[model samples]
Target: MSPPTAPSWSLVPDDLLTEFLSLLPVKSLLRFKC
Candidate 1:
C-alpha cells in the first residue's frame, strides 16, 4: 500500500499549527497568510 502524505494544516491537529507558527518569521507569516 502507498504511504500517506504529510497532513496539511486543515487536516492536522491544533498543536501542529502551533508548532508551525513558532518556526516562521512574523513578516513572512503575515505575507503568506491571512
Candidate 2:
C-alpha cells in the first residue's frame, strides 16, 4: 500500500500568504523557519 500524502497549502493564494507572513513579527517568523 502507498503512504498517505501530506495536505497542501495550494488553496491559499501566494499574495495573501505573503501578506500574512509579512504581518508576523521577526521572532514568530524565525520560530516557523526552524
Best by lDDT: 2
Can you write out model 2's per-residue Cα lDDT over 1-34, one digit (the tens) per residue? 6754633655778899898788788769789999
Give each model a TM-score: 0.39, 0.46
TM-score for candidate 2, please give it.
0.46
lDDT of each: 0.75, 0.76
Cα lDDT of model 1 by residue, 1-34, tens digit: 6755764655878898887777678768788897
Candidate 1: pairs in clash: none
Error of 2 at 26 (Å): 7.1
Residue 13, candidate 2: Cα error in Å is: 0.3
Give residue 28's error in model 1 in angstroms. 7.1
